[model samples]
Target: MDAESQRVLEYLTEVEEGAEDVLATKQQIVDLDTKRNQNREALNALKTEMSDSGHPELRGYNLSPLSTEEIKAMNSILKR
Candidate 1:
């Protein structure tokens, strides 16, 4: 191939690689968005459950402090 043709091919190759990178990044963004939505739904469900259960420690605006057992339970859940 001629010099100009070879240069063009190299430029095209670079463009293709850049496009692939962009696609991979887009996929990652989509996956993260899906995960974020699922986490939000789970959090909302937990909140609803807490409210419905009417546990004194988790009730109204004037909330009391958590007990030692509650703290341990929360810690265990967070570690997971």
Candidate 2:
């Protein structure tokens, strides 16, 4: 009702809005970072599976399932 009270209320509104914006930005950054880490882990797993050299007969069928040609191609990429 009073001018002083009105100014205080206006200032509080501005502060709350700014804080909400900062929190939203931080949440977005955290989400993006989590997604990036997950993708990096998935990529590393795929690379490991592709390059594992244990023969299927020796290691059983549960090992990396790449064929001889695929393994050769992966080796070429590593050499490069």
Candidate 3:
């Protein structure tokens, strides 16, 4: 084969490799964007539901209604 043809084939191979890399990067970006949107929608829905549930009027910690003394006792054990 001619030298010019060999150079052209090498250039084309390089171009193809670059294109494949760009496509893979684009796919990864698209996947990440999709996941972020889904997570945002889920968080917004949860916030709306919590608001509708009147969480503000519940009048206690969401975790437990335990007294401060009980919490201190648990913390002491956890420190060990």
TM-score of each model, paired residue for residue:
0.68, 0.63, 0.67
Model 2 misplaced regions, further than 4 Å = 53-80
Which candidate number has the best lDDT?
Answer: 1
The TM-score measured for candidate 3 stands at 0.67
Tens digits of per-residue lDDT, candidate 3, 1-80, equal 99999999999999999999999999999999999999999999999998888857656755758799999999999999
Clash count for each candidate, listed in order shown? 0, 0, 0
Candidate 1, residue 54: CA error in Å?
0.8
State in Å the error of residue 75, model 1: 39
Alpha-carbon deviation at 12 in model 2, angstroms: 0.5
lDDT tens digits, residues 1-80, model 2?
A: 99999999999999999999999999999999999999999999988987795555667556668999999999999999
> Which of 1 and 3 is the better model by lDDT?
1
The predicted structure with the larger lDDT, 1 or 2, is: 1
Report the CA-based lDDT of candidate 2 relative to the real structure.
Answer: 0.93
Candidate 1, residue 23: lDDT: 100
lDDT of 1 by residue, 1-80 (tens): 99999999999999999999999999999999999999999999999997788877655688679999999999999999
Clashing pairs in 2: none
**How big is the RMSD of model 3?**
9.2
Each candidate's lDDT (Cα)?
Answer: 0.95, 0.93, 0.94
Superior candidate under lDDT, 2 versus 3: 3
